[model samples]
Target: MKNPETFPHPIGLMLFNRFEYSQQVLMSLSAQTLPVDQSKLYISIDGYSGSKAELQGKPDSTHAIEELARATFPNATIRRAEKNIGIAEVYFALEVSMLESHPDANWIGFFEEDYVPSPDYLEITSQLASAAQPIDDIAVVAATGETLDPDNRDVQGIFPIGHLWAYLVRVAHVRERRDDLEVFRQQMSGRPYWDRDKIALALVMASRGVFPIGVANDYQRLSLMFRFNRIGVTTGLSYGEYIGVEGEHMTEKSFARFKFSAPTTVPFDIATVDFSASISTLRDQYRADFAKSLAEQYVIPKIRAFTAQKSFKSLPRRRRVASLLGQAFRALF
Candidate 1:
């Protein structure tokens, strides 16, 4: 068993304009039972990317983030971008740099600004990662587990899709799949979706046959359906909560409601966990929902744009009518 007091992997915490969220995560990290050395904390703060009016109107929050990191994690390495490179690019660059600099690092933990880890979050994640290190198929050990019943937090299992809010991953596995991740990064960069980064990474991991080991929440399960065969989570313990109700990617009205629970105090061994059940039932439901999402997210708008095209409008009346009929046929079937 790996000693809880001597976890060797480094942790990278991604931050943007939200100071309060960042502080909350930092305080949560401070409360962990595992002794995380200050040097193991890497604070990556993104540059200001708002409109000129907002940038010039208010002081950038990066200044405040730097002060907080210096005060709280004095020995931590802080990387502050001079210009906005966006979240995906920032993480990609950070991962590349970390892999190059620390070849001996077996795994690395990533935490987003809004996620508040329970006191045992690090210990649990570290234990899972250490247990899964020798397993060839498991790529990620996530702290966020799925609670089957919204009212009951006890029902949890290893979800097919793992949340990136807080998780530990094998550095070597990610490095090996760097090319695929770059492709995903490019695809997401060209798209205009709220959770493009999350989707891109999830898709790339699925394509590579690397499934995450952790409890699957609804959003993660929905995102990962049809991508993997099975998913599961820890039976008795819950790890952390997604506290990001407001951010650049999400508005107050669009915020997702998440159930928060305290970490498990009982001693549990991750090595004993297994996910062997067929996911056909959930998979079927997910496929139906995904089809609806696809139509709404991609297909309908595309047809509307096609119909509004000048070339289509300039066609003869008969040709235009034919085009409309073709679009309707395609949409229905």
Candidate 2:
């Protein structure tokens, strides 16, 4: 068994033009009870390609991110991109590089700029990773999951999709499949879909039958169902809150609907977590939530918005008459 007192895995923090959000995550990291070696922290700052005139008036967060990492984590390794390679490429390059550089490292935890982790986040993640390292089937230990009830925190399970916001990755598993990941990354890059990159990672893992274990709420489970036919596993308690609602990709309203609060306290004993019951409960909750969302967001909305222009009262008499006739014929069916 590995030493429980020391956490030897490296952590990679991905950053872009979001200083405030990045700083918030850093602050939360500083509050972790687990002792992390500053030298093990790797920060990658992505570059911007816009013209000088375009950037002159805009606020750039990359510079601020470098400064913050240097000042706060003096011995940390910081890599600043010379060009804007996009987030997908950055993640691929960093993960590959880390695995290659540190062959003995068992796992690596990834943190995006906006994810604010709880005080015990590191401790919990290390413990979970330690437990998962021996399990050949478990590919990840995600910090977040789909929780059915917000008030209840005693849930755990395996889930299909993995959240990149905050999670401990099994380096050995990914390293062994580096070629596959590279091909997947190449295929997913430059896609029009906002989450294509994220989905690609999940797809690769799913193909290998290596599911992720973590905490997820009902909403997250439904989101995963749209991509994968199955929901992996989840726990009732959340380790941290996603505070980057106002970030580049998310709208304020959408963030408000999905943002979840972290649990007051998390169970530190990883072995005590019941995988069988958590998986069953998560699947059941997902089915119910998926049905509710389909009805409210799709079925009901489509039904209510099916009327012709005549329903607006501003249509010409002739058009209104035709619309009414069409509506009547449809109703008769």
Candidate 3:
């Protein structure tokens, strides 16, 4: 069970106006340990928007970015939006350009402009993705797993979708639930790219009257890996590095606050790793932990809050039973 000889999926790279950032990633992807040149390469660029331009502090250089992508991946199927579809919608755009365009393909590769995959990224992440495929709950597998490697724990596992830097997703897995995916995409489409990234994990919990205990509530669009039961599966050791500090989500002044790693020049290798190992056995434990936490931290606090509302005492005992729970889970936003 050694790794596959060649990367076997179409690759979609999502970009907007970050020519500098996009250039760094494109060159890195072209230099993967696996010859990804054989895979169908598609670049989806969001159309120009004034507000996005204002946020980036530069006029949209979409045309220049498109040319740079063309120069990097010569045979890429480039799809540039005619109008400024926001960041959330651009993901849907990439899905259509890659997966929908190539119906026979079972899995597709994905990358954002800021993710710099290690040379061995294709080999390792694809192996991680294959391991995740049989398990129905794991939605996507990523290369950037463990940022700071821990001793004896540097193997792939079902972890939270930390950041969707470089990853692979199954076509059939998404296509099977096309309607649901679309509904989700539409739900977050109107938000800024920044909010979409963080709101995902919280969305499902919020709907069910759950919230994190002193944790920031932000799932992801790439983090869309969260739809309640689904979790991101990735190698425990980080396979890639996230370099987008000042893009949609961060500023130079605030970059240090997030504790981001400086982009690395060091090479990562997958020497003598076991390919036959699977993480299926650990899912139950993770779920059990989640249930335990939900019961203690998330659910109980809500119950306490609901009981605090004056409505609890204002209503007769019979009326309080059903409506009380409904108010807690209500989608006020």
Candidate 4:
């Protein structure tokens, strides 16, 4: 609030090789009502040395991304890793860089190249952050609101899930949890970014009472979120589109299996909403959605596996129907 040259909330973007998406991000960011200042924009890109062959002779993509970023903002601070240090490491390192660079900032917004943010992304997240100031447990604020139709901006409510599509994380929480992340990093020290068994990671996290999903980096945050009984809030209407039909973690086949109740656009003219009032509404919604998702994602497969057991099939029809549930319940609990 004291300096006009400094951005209200310093922000950064984490990316690998998605130049086009990064460009879109920069353009949208540049167009922010909250202008994207060179002093405020930081870019952290992962190395592509190992993927030079995969990238088809583009071993210098990090340089290209830097050039592109500077051309847009002209003074953007860019951190390019020399080797492929992995997204998880790059992300945390970027956070530390932002913290050290903008010591006065209370929070930092982080984005990925896979999603294209709404023009109002900065303003909305700022409002969300301001509204969330008193709520310590709400560690992050996102623009991932859900609507039956993404194009229709009726503002159903804040999304109940922790979506990193575009998010703002509180500095205090990050400082408090940095040690936890270091421990997680140590646990995953030698593993390549793409080589993680996400299912196993989710299962391990579930045992610790955290939501059982996301990549290694995302999982690390989720663990901290649960550790302090914190939650992330989102806009009432989605603030971006997911154009990552095929990226590091998704393929055309895998992407097709996924669906969104909302389509591919964010409302451009949203007035500032005081989301602090609706925080509990979002929390309640998350509880219900998590319960439903847990059942559908975990329980049904378990029931199917139970019914398929030879011993289960051998039981009389009446007893087998009831007995199948016994095993599923045991597995679930």
Candidate 5:
């Protein structure tokens, strides 16, 4: 039995450029079955500029968001960034700032702009976290009901990184790890590891025996399809696959784009969709056909003749000489 007052978990929602979608995200938050008093939701508007052009461009979007929060949810705080900060910086800054500001908060959930939760999203997640086993590691139950491939049996309780939009962390765990984040910051700096921070962090935590607890039952209401381009991630809404009576037609709506994961409307045809066997058979058939096509298109005699020619060998030497000459010319100049 957890004390609601002492174990309160505040939720933090990150917003980058998309303003319209924030409204939906808030609406979903307002609908959460969990006690809203213990739950303090913060909406941080990253890259906020107060100039007339900036304000004018975002008038309707900003007004609607502010009004909704003020009229209905006054406890939800909104932080506007004076200058644009990239996602990496914004995430780190918010994590540190919020944890420091709300030291008494028991848990904190981090969400992206597009994640829309079911009504029980918060309550069920809270219960799962409360009942989760293996206390040593950070706990995150998957909120996105839809996974990459339903038939893809190779799945784990811990999901892929981009799906980290709806994750909850025990506040103390986050505070304890706050000092250690610089290690990740340095590891991510000056490299291509910018986008996979969540994955990287999860992997790091798991390496230290921080395992995630999975809850399959609560995620029944989630979508079966993924949206990709919506959040610039290769998974989720970007998949473009649809199900249901109006599944195909629903693709045209912009709001649908906000939901990166939606359940399949039509029941999966399991008879024709033996994904495991289909993948193996397709691989073997494609390899055989590809080998035959290659043999027909590329005769060994022609390949030998082409390889024997000195053109390929000369290319590297030519490049080296050009590089050296360019250096010499620069030196002389």
Candidate 6:
């Protein structure tokens, strides 16, 4: 039998928290020149905690969201969670729900509350997903906010740079791996680490050799990695040992309190940037400074001593070998 025609609106965006950021994403989607009716919008709100006076009718979050629906896009379906699930759980739950709801959809697009899709975001996604027939192990196609070198841009199609804040993923590829996500969550449960759930998903997808599509100059999405590092490691643990008992040490100087701005801006054109393509020069400067401090104060001296000790290296290498193997398997299929 011949394959079914892919829908132009194969993309479904998952939105949660960040009311202000969500509003920006919604407005950007609304502003797209393509037919909005072709695509579907799903918003998953965890809970609203802000000035009660700011809300209309002083109602709860669901009610406030309902009011938002009436005032804004009433047609957009809004899903509300009763309790507060962390970012990772919320994203996973909503993604599973999206796949269940749209079983026939070729691709489900992921967008954080903070992302503002460019004019051709959906158009380009649909076009690429449709044009790339005989989809093999491919799972994701995304906007790499980091501009590729002029040489590599056209090579092997475009490679997704980084920052998975916004991307389109194959539905079947995701649904088939839903069970594994719970396993991943369980593995990472007690570790108390947090970051973009999509990054975890990307790692899992890439493990299976599923390539993330990168369309040059399509859109820009900000990376929220540093915020997660601060919250997870800096405040959570004072001095901890990672990678089993014989692994690296986490010390006081390894972490520090840092302040970040909400609703940070991302530049459209990045003519000048380090290889990392950091949007803000100041942000890059601060991160570089922090890295230097960490190496000097906490990591370098200790790591040097640890490596120099011959007895430490002679300790059981079996566990380390097994652990490295497991990580490699998890990251590469």
**Top candidate when judged by lDDT against the true structure:** 4
Candidate 3: segments with Cα more than 4 A from true spot: 1-6, 55-57, 146-160, 188-228, 261-281, 285-333
Question: Which wins on TM-score, candidate 2 or candidate 5?
Answer: 2
Model 4 residue 292 CA deviation in Å: 2.8
- Which runs in model 4 stand beyond 4 Å of their true positions? 1-7, 51-60, 146-155, 197-211, 214-216, 260-276, 316-326, 329-333
Candidate 4 residue-wise lDDT, 1-333, digit = tens: 222333478777887776777788777777766666678778888877654324466435567777787787778788777777777788778887789989988888888887777766777677778778887767888776642123323355555444566788899988887776665666556766676667666655556555543445774685466567667766556567767764776778876765533433645333445456766865666556545655665677788887778988888988986786776676567
Model 5 sits at a Cα RMSD from the real structure of 14.3
Ranked candidates, highest lDDT first = 4, 3, 1, 2, 5, 6
Q: How far out, in Å, is residue 267 in model 2?
A: 5.2
| lDDT of the candidates, in the order given | 0.60, 0.59, 0.62, 0.68, 0.45, 0.43
Kindly give the stretch of ten consecutive residues in candidate 3 with the minimal lDDT sum. 214-223
Q: What TM-score do all the candidates reach, one by one?
A: 0.66, 0.66, 0.69, 0.82, 0.49, 0.50
Clash pairs detected, candidate 3: 146-238, 156-235, 198-218, 198-219, 200-219, 201-219, 220-224
Per-residue lDDT of 1-333 in model 5, one digit per residue for the tens? Answer: 323432246677776545556666666666655555523666676654532324446443444455655555676677766654445555677676667778776667777656666555566456535543234232343345433232221222222222344666556555554443554455455532223355555455335433222111111101111110011011122111222112112234653554434532332121332223333443343334333433433344354554466764456877756754554444322
lDDT value, candidate 5, whole model: 0.45
Better of 3 and 4 by TM-score: 4
Give one digit per residue, the lDDT tens place, for model 3 in 146-262.
321222134433354445567777775666546655555556556654455445635654464444432231223322333345555555555667777756667777867655543
Q: How close is candidate 2 to the true structure, as a TM-score?
A: 0.66
Model 6 earns a TM-score of 0.50
